[model samples]
Target: MALHPTLQAVTERIVARSQPSRAAYLAHLDAARVQGVQRTALSCTNLAHGFAAFPANDKLKLREQKKPSIAIISSYNDMLSAHQPFERFPQIIKDAVRQVDAVAQFAGGVPAMCDGVT
Candidate 1:
């Protein structure tokens, strides 16, 4: 499993931005690695679920892999999928951003939306 250059840049960008405390990042990463699975892992109900990615070592390798199939970043920050395959990539990244928004609300990082899903 060799890493591609594009993926390497992505991994680096995540690290640079998230700037997690080493221990917390490791813990969260472990949790995500154990709890997380591949993006294409299909289940009937999973299509509606939001993904949580924690920056840890095991997952980090996959995050660095060539062609980079999935995203591995802090669960709280919104992911960028501004321009992608007009189909699934947009949805997947939007889902991740929504998940972060939901969690950030509970943590009081951002104000809760009374109107919802703006």
Candidate 2:
């Protein structure tokens, strides 16, 4: 089915507006690919800090740059019951990644505030 004329016009305008930024992003991606993965380019101290909390096996693989690692950043804190369920998400994500032969780490968390409490 054809897109509605109004929708098509809007889409074209968005695409035109985004061209420069899209090209720049693609260029950056190509440059990074040529330079190889980010972790492999890290200095020794930086790499250590990045993998400081990884399990021994994962740390070894990451050090060798032989496997991919996923970082899970969450805004979960005990202060909000809504976010409490996220407490177990890191482990769940780690196990799922392990099944696919990748490593996962709970990179960090941000404090979550409840409007009702404050």
User: Clashing pairs in model 1?
Assistant: 4-66
- Could you give candidate 2's per-residue lDDT for residues 10-89 as a string of tens digits? 99999999999999999997896677556856788988888898889888878777677888998877767787777898
Top model number, lDDT: 2
Candidate 1 Cα lDDT to native: 0.44
TM-score of 1: 0.20
TM-score of each: 0.20, 0.63
lDDT of 1 by residue, 1-118 (tens): 8789999999999887777676687998798767654545655355223222432432344333321233323223233343233334444663564454321112112322332433
Alpha carbon RMSD to native, model 2: 4.8
Candidate 1: which stretches are off by over 4 Å? 1-20, 38-69, 72-118
Assess each prediction's global lDDT (C-alpha) against the native.
0.44, 0.82
